[model samples]
Target chain A: MMDLVYTPDQEAFRAEVRAWLAAHVPKVPLASFDTAEGFAAHREWERTLASGNWGMVTWPESYGGRGCDLIQWLIFEEEYYRAGAPARVNQNGVFLLGPTLMEYGSEAQKARFLPAMASGEEIWAQGWSEPNAGSDMAAIRCQAIRDGDDYVINGQKIWSTRAVYADWVFGLFRTDPASERHHGLSKILVPLSAQGVTVRPIPQLNGLPGFAEIFFDDVRVSVDNRLGDEGAGWQIAMATAGFERGLMLRSPARFQQASRRLVSLYRQHHGDLMDPAVEDDVLRCYMDAEAYALSTYQTASRLLQGGSIGPEASCNKIFWSELDLRIHDTAMRILGARAEVEPSGSSDQEDLGTWLDGFLFAQSGPIYAGTNEIQRNIIAERVLGMPRR
Target chain B: MNFTYSAEQIEFRDVLHALLQAEVGAERIRARWDTASGRDAALEAQLRDFGLYSLMFPESLDGLGLSVIDCALLAEVCGRAALPEPAVETMMVASPLLVDVLDRGLGNGSVQAVIEGVMSGDARVAVSHAINPHVNFVEDAHWVIAGVADAIYLLPRDKVEVTPLKSVDPSRRIAKIDFDPEEQYRLAEGEAAAAVLRSTLNRGALSVAAQLVGLSEVLVEQSVRYASDREQFGRAIGVNQAIKHHLADVAVQIEYARPVIARAAYTLSVSPERADIAVSHAKLAAARVGLLAARHGIQVHGAMGYTWECNVHIWSKRIWALVREWGDEGFHKNRLQQWLLQSNALLGPEFTFGRRSLLPDSRVSDPVSADTAA
Candidate 1:
């Protein structure tokens, strides 16, 4: 039974997920459009999953999920990658806020928001990463004043993913000006339809409106919309960030997909007879992917047996992020001349434009989700027990 | 799953560290390097009494049943002190296979006698081969384990001739042992002994790699301290971008290589099948880092580094010799390429493709919680 560590039941689950994905995944041709209609199509794909009750596979059934273990979720992700499902458009809500709400939301808040959230009826966006508070999130200047029954929020959140399309913005605002850093912070869920709120989409390198800059001017949110206590925002936001950094957001299935695409591209273009340096880099990418996959599997297995994540998760995050960059760089090297220009329109080629796009996207990996340098500092000081410099 | 050291391994490391601190400090190491025999017999006996000698062989064959990882921890301490002892050469090389043969009565009692002799501080053994240029003081060995044909050329001193050559490192000497075909108790000729010997050689390289890591670590620490304290003009030399960046680069190299060495050692101890690829990668990474670290250690020391008074030369020379031994960077890289070609046959094309596709988007999201974070 323990030959390859998977059981017949797990295999059966994989088949079931594969079959479901085959039947439901949309076959509409995509042209890499930047219009609202294209994004709407992506959102509709997410809604399809929600309608089928396949959204948030690991969340509680009450929140419109299957309430499955990590293994089943992993299987579902594998199938999702295999079936080439359109990437999730509401990642901020489905991956981050949805999990945070499940953990820390009030009974009233859960009953009010979770159903719509799970059904993709409302889209959510993160309000972290201010202009000056990229890696140092605690230095955010966004402030909130406690009124009689509501908190008036006034600040700007830059690099807010999908904020232009999102119906809700979950953010951290300083509730106590007298208190020091990270103290007196409160997490508030504000409806984007409120007065004095505007979201302008930020142009990314791939010419996609991948993120936005949100301006909140005296936006009033009911105190009941707070995810946790006023001062507990830092901790609750940390939970969301952890999910952002961990398996919930960055699954092994994604890496598996990337590795597969790279190998195909290498074979197609380089045909295994590329420059020795390129071959070495490709080999290194494979090794790093395998190591990361094995390490993550161990982490997931521990979580399945009810073990808490440790500082080593930072190590895992840094490794995969750096590795992701290396693999995409190798793909660019393979693509050679064509890797420079952006793809005009989506050709049927497997990885020509995709690799270039991914290469561009990988540039931000080390900066977002906490910089690689910070992660290294965490690994050195926290995991390896080295003294902080 | 079991990441932390076992209680016994922890205790073993603590005792070994204490012993190394007391008996193999810089002054003692320098004295041993100057001595005719490059070893301290009394201290060697003390280590044997602490069960360090029994670590490599199996418990059934009079060993301590310790893994290569345990031996690696000891190697780190020994390397830091530049201790001139055959701890690694003896344990990693001779103890496992040679002792196994001696215990099984397949080899001469002379092999077993040398083992008992080392345990009692009465005799020493060192290996030499033209194929590998890292052998130290092979002529001085009472017994030499040389590779001739498919079997170990176990030559006694009476049957072989030795011609000593001056080595750059003071802690070790080199000599070619001309093995005479007329004398030897046994030769186990088969793939079994060859496989075991190959594994032993890889483990030996990995042990040295661990030692090199320790040596590089000390070099970085010493260089940083010197940079901080050694002032020139109005500021410390460390304030200079050249000096500071040099030390920082050494540090980064150490970080890149040390984990590979540790992982290789772990593979040798637990999974023999993966040891080939693991050791190749470990050797390639370590050789590059060890050379850079050792050379930079001297460069950071300036004029004083060129002198015999400083112990940096001893560690640097050892790093060079050990890295070049077994398989150097180029040799290991080629080996890795070969291994990859072979392994490609077993893995499906989809496996590699899947890895590439999945790896780029791979993210291990940090779970939210102080308990999880810390």
Candidate 2:
């Protein structure tokens, strides 16, 4: 009744995943998928992976996946990170929207989007937060007016990751002219190639166009693009958000890989560094990552028993985001002055410069996928059943 | 792989929780605080009759043949209720050692009497591990189980000279025991003794971890209840973002720790060889959350938590005591580091559940995946 042993099939699957990744994972790490060249390179890698049917292992085989369970997906991720495989440029499509579509989209929509999503033929940018709708997502005011067979969308989406090189965007828009807040909104899938769509790249702290501002000027997308029914966008978006904030987007193995690297970073410096605090920090990172991994497995186990991820997703979001911050923060502290040194050409620079890049990027962990403050409030009100203001 | 409790495990836990709820409330726990022994005879007897002490013994001895996994949640229940008993050692720690010794044909005459007495609700046994010098509830114990250097003994309580100590937790009757790990009382020696001692220490840590997790829940629950009822800034403090956030953080820690503790119990039951590492993880996580629960629990209570009259202090103080006992922070942290520092330490998400297989090594060839020798 209580067991933690992975089945022989699962072990074989992990071995197969490891072996394939070892053989096919790029010898030279692909560039950050934010730039155009990097984007195309990552897309090529995804195509290579898709050729091996390694695109989104949890999805059905018809959609270019192995139709694996969550455990297998976790194993796939473990090997993926271990292999230092290129980041999936189509994360927004495969990780976030793909699951949402499977849950809420029509059969036609699934057939239309999933294979391309998994194959990285169409990279997606999430249109979640706006200038006014950052933490308060219910403050969404973007309009998508219904006209005959098309919904002409207008207004802007800010902080859209990958929108700079993305081919499509999935967003929430106000359908009813009189509608306010989260009500009367619909989730619409739109192509960046649409006539009136404008993608303006936003340079991040590291001076990269990792983000973008998407402006839709009366862009007409077919009614068939709307996921679920009109006015049901909030519920559908929340489910997508549950996937975003929970296991799918930021898997535990990602942090574990980071933590392992952090530990390696410490071991290299453990001799010269007299700071026991660094050792403590490294230990905390390792243990916290393990705890997070164990927690995900527990959630997956429960989910396998037909349980849904509830408000506990907020807790997971907060845990991993903050953990990501701690890991990079510790690496920076361990590196000290040399942390900022971009020793790019040298092999020594790989670990050093990678830590610096990760440190810069880790700042966004607490901000994106819903802020930690907002997550804490959700945990309080929903999970703890506390009184809300 | 299933990570769930059986119907038997759940039912036994529920019944024990029900009985503890009915018999050993905060008031009952408070009642024992005034006495140095911290024993409620009526409640202890009821607990024994309800299959608490005899839970881990063999079925042939008129006891439930339950392992640590089945009995683990009961430790948590006892913790949640702040049950002032040495039930942890009697059940999770000493019981297994007693069974092991019995299997070696060592429980003869007096040892056999002690075993039968403990099972049949007539006697209580407290244990003293080498890692923890202070024995809790020694005055109330009929026999003392002591593990030292290379031998373990089941000595009569009267044989050990006990020195009373100033207790931190009001419900704990703390003492340092001077037990002779002599021949007549010795249960097992040499490798047999070391093996039992190692596992028993892990069991102690795991049981305490379960209790700490449960203790943390009480602190959060009490604070949440108080925050909702208490008004501040013209509304219930529970509505304040500050209060909610504090409790929420504690709740998050609890959510993570609960599964780790359960996993530790599973490890102890299924793979005792790996229990040290697993149990240390459980211990470290529980201790962290337990301490966090106290810090936030007190802050959320304001002046009330600082007061002795408040029940929050009762649970908080118990958390403080439990955290320092059963392989403290440094002990467990060092244990984990030692295991993790090994070159062959199979880490990553895949090895989290499964043991090291005979599968030929791959992936460790990756620089980051390669383990550094410590």
Candidate 3:
């Protein structure tokens, strides 16, 4: 167990990433973009990361990737956020799409797509959740009928994050509509640049087009674009979701940092008018964050030691997501009416506004990446040996 | 980072538990407490004959030479039995340092006598509060290993006047001691004396904390069992959220206290540099949580648990006594804050461990020093 202890080399690796991020992350007076400009700047930031060979960490070096260990990738992320690096524009690619491509994409497909994907030349967006298939992906009605050597896809995917600015779309399509619910699906990689594909942005309560709806009309893609075997789309999509559960999504240290920030903010705003109960709540948040960090570290150690991410990963996800919501909520409570006040000027205004943005975004944490309800159900049914209804 | 016990440690704990259960079972524990020495003489003799009493001493001193972790494991079983014995006073205090002090102060004659006495179970020594400056229980002891602000006071049982005091736990004796100031033995003095006493006292406190953790485990486990087995309104009381959640809270306390106690014991055994903070944390955490388990054990067991006929009161009183023994929660927390301020401010980031949210609903318990010390 103590073998999880880091050696000097790991510390040196952390230092190296810290120094690199501090030097390369732009200090430009860039606005917190909520529109197309934000997307452009975010894309530019991804390019900057690519230039530093820090993009697609843990991906093969042959595909413009570093081929670093997961620990190294985590270290890079830690420093990236510590240095206040710009938002990762290709979150869909790096988190959801890239790993799937590496796992199920053919050699020709990898050779064709991995480099551009890593270099931030082409951004990918998820086209999985549709109007009727939000939580029920197998209920998807999107059809991809095979014609000659090409598959003609015609369907509408909704709540597709970043599809409005995406260069390509990757998702599951029911290639055999008459087949069984899950057996009918096939994972397809479709180019959003196709003349028949149309994208429309959906404005969220946060006033950002963080999501979009994409309509496919006779879009054509070669059979080679299908990941894995036919009717294996459910397996491929599950693998992507599994990756999202593990290394691709939030890091526990990230939550730890946020919890610390909440503590510091609480300290900053201490006054007689403030409710003293907030103090205990803030401390509770810190404890939750710490426990979650320890749990995640244990998970990372297990993975490093060649262990599979088991049902415990679900526990870690449920823990950290709930912790994230609590910490952000605490920050909102601490900010009080200022959270409601729009920023007129100054960085303090921007910082408070950004926290408010995070507060708004954090509401979806339990709903996304396998809802906490689903997670608890898994824990009760699979891990805790409860009888399933 | 390794939080597991070695196989030897596990075997040792198992054997010790069996020995304790057979010798000083709960049935005999109360009667032993009513005795003069507050322990079972036959059990003590057997443990001594088995080399258990010599754990903290070196081989050169005719001891088993075990680590503090070994002592902690043994103490835990003693805690579970609520067995009032001088094993802690001797192993934690007298054997480790007093023997050497005796050797130095009164030459080899006194040293040899005390060592043989401890080994043979004939000579029972206790720490007196004369040294503590606030409390004294030396009169209740055959030999009072006492210390003062500037001197070591070896107040023999014959010298100090003793008066029995009302105690929260009748199983252990507590007394007010009046000592002759000029009769100080002065075994070790000044900074060296202070350092030795602090180290010894801290080790004792750590041992007590570990034992309290063990006792809390018993209380919580038994309460949980009772809750599961006892039915109320056609279902086990455990089904009631109030009862299960209380038991769960006690479970949380045990979980949180275990690591702090382990860390404190480990620090005392391996690296003394970190002992102060580790012991304070351990004492504070254990005492606070132990008190909760004690109180909740009663509530969980209801009216039957509050009576002397039930063993719940036995565990509760023992927990209460031990909580206020060395340094209660308030004193230890103050000490921790003091140490935090006075110590070299290194990279000590204040990250709360275990479950901090549970603190709001739990009451912190005080530490109980045996009659010997304040």
Candidate 4:
């Protein structure tokens, strides 16, 4: 009955997660995954997590998960972030596509991809936005023409996150040439190493290839690689996009961790940098993180009680994307001149530039997973029942 | 942890929503704006008859003995209706304070009579905490629970001189109360009085927060309705992206504020030790968002928002009055800052609603952990 108090079993589960994370979390932070060595290091960390069956706890046990409910997953995430663990390099696979596959994938498809995804054997990238279809995702002109039991794909996808080092990509491609907009689209899974596929790393503000531009020149994949049915790509992609925008992709723990760091940073410098305005901003980041966490818990509870995610996901997306930007911005403000100095190495104590790097990445939050503007439109029209133009 | 209300709670909320909608019409509240008392006696009587006044009192006192969450649920509805009865202050603040005073054996016959009068709908109570400069709706209240220094006094309204103070919200009648501290009846003093005052202030802040959330929702609803019906450039203004985005921001603010208020209410009922942080969070979030909603509501309605005829100012003014009622943004933020600096609490994902003691052994490095530990 609207119980915010955790049960004894849940508390016990939380204690277990805390103990495990304390023992296993790296004492030193890992390098940024923009570099190949850092990417490999992150992969190894994922393998360590998989060995503990903690890579994706909400997934079914058959896929190396504990089959825990969303609340337990939230608890695990809280501990995972609290312990100062490395970021999930395979978030694209595990948080976004993994849930989508569990929902719409066939038994064989789940058997093939889920284990690899859970084990970090095959990292994934999202290939949603094209040069023209940034916010208007349905305007994607990428085509996957049918050729017997295979589809010959040809398109250029921009802003494909983690594509340079990822093994596979999942995206939407127009299957029927005559159809327009969202109609007759298909979600095709393509291996990054397939013939006629080219990945050009796009250096972000951090001078790292965090995302890439993928050129597909008649890259053929079997028809079985398609998720859901043909002509239903838009719907399936919407579901995946919902998952990406909603609870799974950006868990509250991530923001909470950042908020904690921000608080610590504030405490470290409040003597010299103690402005009421700055103090208020710091408190705002903390409170917003808590609010987001509480809201997510409410959403998870509702879903467990047989509720489905709807346009309210749009509200969540807008709140969190903006909140992510604000939290990092507050941190950078606290860092002042130190924010400009890039870290010489992962162990550089004087390098406060990770906050700067984080700020740069947060700038993309509102622009990705459907821009915050688009999300507001969805909320206004769908959730609030306002009129559409 | 379950974050959803039970079916019974949902039903209670729905029923309260319907009752407020049917009973407390906007015209009824608007009518009180010009009255001297700035209260609708009929509506107050109706609410008391509906058993809202006794929702927080002990069952032995013939109350519903509901949790703070329940009181908050009702407070939101009252805010939505712009209900002008001090129902929130009376039920959520005063009654709870009085109940505690009696339970602590600090209250005498006069306090008991006032409590009985409150349950029977014969008396109306208004609280004037030190945080608030004026006692709200003092003219309509029979008993005024005023906090002076470290002690609390229960005084009959006739024993004090209340000078009327104009509020931005015309329906919210406020006054500066003056009385002889020695002549009034002392309810409690020392630690007992301090505890009662603390609980009263927390509940008062939480009530206003919940009400502000309700007021924000109403503002959003009104703005959306006006945007939909008021056409500009050959279409509804709501179809315009600018208008839609403004309203959507308001909606998001309201959406996030709800859970904070709920969690605060739950914490107040279940864990008093955590009530300060929780209520401060709730108050700051709701007041900030409520003010934003008020500004946006006026902007969305254009010039019509400024006029009395549009009805937007009714809720807008109430939001202005309520934001500073129990605790303003600065007040709550300062409280949170003090707590943060003093305790060095484990500020992280794991400790959002949890105690600092919940942190693992490796993380307890703060000097204040011994005192702050749950």
Candidate number achieving the greatest lDDT relative to the actual structure = 4
Candidate 2: misplaced stretches above 4 Å?
A: A243-245, B104-108, B358-374
Q: How accurate is candidate 2 locally (lDDT)?
A: 0.83
Between prediction 1 and prediction 2, the one with superior lDDT is 2
Model 4 C-alpha lDDT per residue in residues B58-128, reported as the tens digit of each score: 89987888888888988988899888888888889999899888888887668878988998899888888
Per-residue accuracy of model 2 over B64-90 as CA lDDT, tens digit each:
888888878889988998887887768
Clashing pairs in 4: none
Interface DockQ of candidate 1:
0.09
Q: Give model 3's DockQ, 2 decimals.
A: 0.10
TM-score values for chain B across all models = 0.84, 0.93, 0.85, 0.94
* Model 3: per-residue Cα lDDT over B1-374, one tens digit each: 23344558768878888887777766787776566656555777788876777777777777787777777777888788777675766777677666546534542235566667776667777775322332323434567666666556665578767777757776767776667765345467776666666767687787788778878878877786677677767777765556655655555445445555655666676554346666776777678678898988899898878788888877888898888767666566656444322212111111222112212322321111111111
lDDT of 2 at A38: 85
In candidate 2, position A275 carries an lDDT of 59
* TM-score for chain A, prediction 2: 0.98
Please give each candidate's TM-score: 0.79, 0.96, 0.66, 0.96
The lowest-lDDT stretch of 10 consecutive residues in candidate 3 chain B is B365-374
Q: Write one digit per residue (lDDT tens) for candidate 1, span B164-243.
A: 76777777777655756554544454654565566666776777777787778777777766666777787767656566
What's the iRMSD of model 4?
A: 1.7
Candidate 4 local lDDT, residue A225: 98
lDDT by residue (A1-389, candidate 1, tens digit) is: 00113455665776777778888888864434345877678777777888778888887888888887776776677778767888777777888888788889988898888878877788888888899888788988888889999888888999988777778988888888777678888888999899999888988877777788988899888889888888898988877566435767777667667865675566566554556687777666655554454445545555665667754456556666777899899988887777776665645554576778788888988777777666655544444333332
Q: Report the C-alpha lDDT of model 2 over A1-389, residue by residue, as the tens digit.
A: 77777778877888898889988998988778887888899999999999999998988999889889888887888878878888888888888899999999999999999999988899899998888999999899889999999999999999999999988999899999798898999999999999999999999977889999999899999999999999989999887777544888888889888988877766667677555787777778887888888888877877887877755677888888889999999988988888888637578678788888888989999889888898898888887888885
Candidate 1 chain A weakest ten by summed lDDT: A1-10
Question: Can you rank all candidates by DockQ, best first?
Answer: 4, 2, 3, 1
